[model samples]
Target: MSGIVFAIPGDIDAPTGGYGYDRRLLREWHEAGIEARHIALPGSFPFPTEADLATTERLLAATAPDDVLLVDGLAFGAFPEALAARFADRLVALVHHPLAMETGLKPEAADTLRRSERLALARARTIVASSPTTRATLETEFGVPASEIVVAAPGCDPAPRASGSRGGAPLRLLAVGSLIPRKGYGDLVEAAAAIADRAWTLTIAGSPDHAPETAAQLRSVIARDGLADRIVLAGAVGPDKLAQLYDEADLFVMPSLYEGYGMVLTEALARGLPIVTTLSGAGAEALPDAAALKVPPGDAAALAKALARLIDAPAERRQRADAAWAAAGDLPRWSETARIVAEACLRDRASARNAARGFREKPMQDQRAREQD
Candidate 1:
């Protein structure tokens, strides 16, 4: 087996869904006897410095021509033309989400990002998207050929069933995702305020540092709404604590405006927690109709109403939790996710090798024909 290098631009174990996926996939692949390894790049992705570019050049230059390099799109999608063209031959892009589509970017800046990503992705032999929704966007919006794109959704680890907020306890709501503008956390706060009359408390556990200003803003909102006690910003938590939160919680709610795959939703499902999330990006696709109550993105009023209804109906919540548990049985495992990506990369490597051989042979055949004539 040839080398498999994951060229991620930050810590593989970062407290986020995409990083978690990369870490799990690489670990699983290594366990399955693949020559998988991680290569760290500059952490300041999507806006790397000159030193970062220099490091990338040196690293790619050192990679064996036969080796497969999987570049996380956070860094790869924003690569300049020269950097991208240098190692384009064997590069495979792991696109968690399109950088251009993230919220809070100015139109001009978004266009620039779109252009750069298109160029960067054009060099990849194939783009492995986290979901079908992302794959479609790659083909239609980014001009990537449909044949050059693949979809491999994230996997979920099975978790202890949630104990549920029963026995006259206040309904517990959990929303997980990094605190960024795109996640619609403001909407979540508003929705929480709307349901202020109900017996519920909300916990948002995510990487507050990912967007510090947003975190501060959320704190301000919590204070302004007089929900400082009711709404707790748990900040970035470890796996053990997160699982404990899940086990103790009653409901999973997310107001994200978009997601590449919304791996947390699957995690929520794995724990048999009924969900109340907006129908946005892959989050909508991952959620089963029976397992969740879906609402449009940015509609705090509707979100609040949904929460209120579920709070009043204990039987319905129980039924939905049961449905979520049933759905968990069929969720993809980490091993399967790793196998899919490994197989895709290996398959394309072989195809590229065969095509190169055919190209080399074509001239000889043409010369033989000329001599016969």
Candidate 2:
């Protein structure tokens, strides 16, 4: 059997969550004996530009008709109808989260994007979401039938790192994600401020892409809260550096306002780090009950309380960390995720071929004429 080919528009350079998911998916597909390729699209603001469209067109023209085109949510959300029409027969869209529903966008812009997403999803041969929350939203918000959508949760790297020595004085806390409003970093900074007198240091690591204003606001908050000395912004570190940080950290916090599926949470869990997060999206669903400390989104006081609890109770923290490590062991590997995706793509392709053959064998108009006769 010929292998599946995925045409993803996720940028390879940046450290975005979607890019991480795509990277892992591709790795998994290859391990599962599925031939998968990612076509990088040009970077554009808000949506894919004319250049991106042209690049996608070129890729489509070159690809075999039977090859599965796995479109990422970013590109699908950006140019829904056109992509759907162009690759209607062999297209499967992977939605991490609904970009149109993010709170940061203007009402009119959000509405336009949402409309485009609906149209694009409708045109897909199959739609795979990263979380059940996303699947439900697709059915409820976009009116997509439940039967057409499948939920394939994101996977984490399984390798364990050697334990690093904890430095003296301050307890180390790490938060990793793009420095944006949705990440709730500003709120975390505020929470950090509330406990500034405590001996704890925070490292915020991620590349900034969207909402420069939010990044600016977070910086301002950090300075104003007198956390300048305690907080550090380590922008866009490589995987090795990130693994080192995770190994060294005493705690991990991701107070995201929303997520499709939180791959970072899984990564942190894999490192055996106790976590603090909000109940925002499907990503939060990955949290093991005993391993995580939950707080309401945008609530600095609650976050502060959670942080304080973790800091003050050393024995409990260690226990939670141990539990987190054990829970991480249960997460699906990239190879497993790839196998499921490859199987789904193969099934969709076979279904499309059968439908096409049926259409050719019995013309609808001819059947209607025979009924009349």
Candidate 3:
């Protein structure tokens, strides 16, 4: 293979799960001696401006002919079919989740994305999904063949066991993710309000920049429900601060409407923190029953009930925490994720070469047949 060019649309170092996964994969490949490099595309993805799209096209077109271009789905799924076709043979789509499945899209916009993603995914040499939920969605909903997709779940880094609050002063609940509608921050705030009788403080550590309106709305609701004192939106934090936050957390909560794979859940497990999460997309299977209390997505009442259950019972929380720690050992590592993606890239390269060889030989074989005739 000439090289593997990882094309990502926004800041690769962004604290979001998708970017974190992409960053880790590239880092692992570099450490493992695999020849790979990053190509920064326009940040306005999933809805790029015309100028950004043109710039993206130029950046992609500059890749070496034989380089396997693994494009992140945020931009790839929104590319016009004509542009997608230009690099179809070398393109590999890295789909965290279908863009159309995002929580707050208008029907027409969803339809457009669904159609565009279907076309883009179909054209790519291979599709790499972050979870089986995503892979199945591509196969059934997006009309991509199962054989063309690879599921490379995000890896969890090992961490020290969180020293949860002792003697039960108050529960320390932590929810991490960008303040986007799809993360269900509103639902989480509502749920937290319902359980105000419980002695607990919730800290949501994520970027507010991803959705300023959602962040504002969350703040309004937190104040409206008289939870302003109990809830803290810590915005984004660096890795050290995040790790420290994780260390002090008593419980990990994720109320996302959907996740291709909940990397934070595994991170919680790595630190032996009990979990409360929604059964949305991969979140349903991201953690074992013993490690989490799961309720349906968007169900604030059910979420509040689950939160209460874990809050009132310290023994139960410890049991779940222990289970989480036990499960952590089985979580995929960054190295393994990199290995699977590297294998996929290599396989696509080989397949492309074989297809090109067949294309070259076909005309010669036809000419020979004509001469014999």
Tens digit of lDDT per residue, candidate 3, span 110-171?
A: 99999999988879999999999999999889899999999888877767789977684688
What ranges in model 3 sit over 4 Å off? 347-373
TM-score of each: 0.92, 0.88, 0.92
State the TM-score for model 3. 0.92
Q: Candidate 1: where are CA atoms >4 Å away?
A: 347-373
Model 2 global lDDT (CA atoms, 0 to 1):
0.77
Candidate-wise lDDT, in order: 0.83, 0.77, 0.86
lDDT of 1 by residue, 307-373 (tens): 8878889899889999998888677766666766776676456643532332344344434443453
Clashing pairs in 2: 262-283
| Higher-ranked by lDDT: 1 or 2 | 1
Superposition error at 12 for model 2 (Å): 2.0
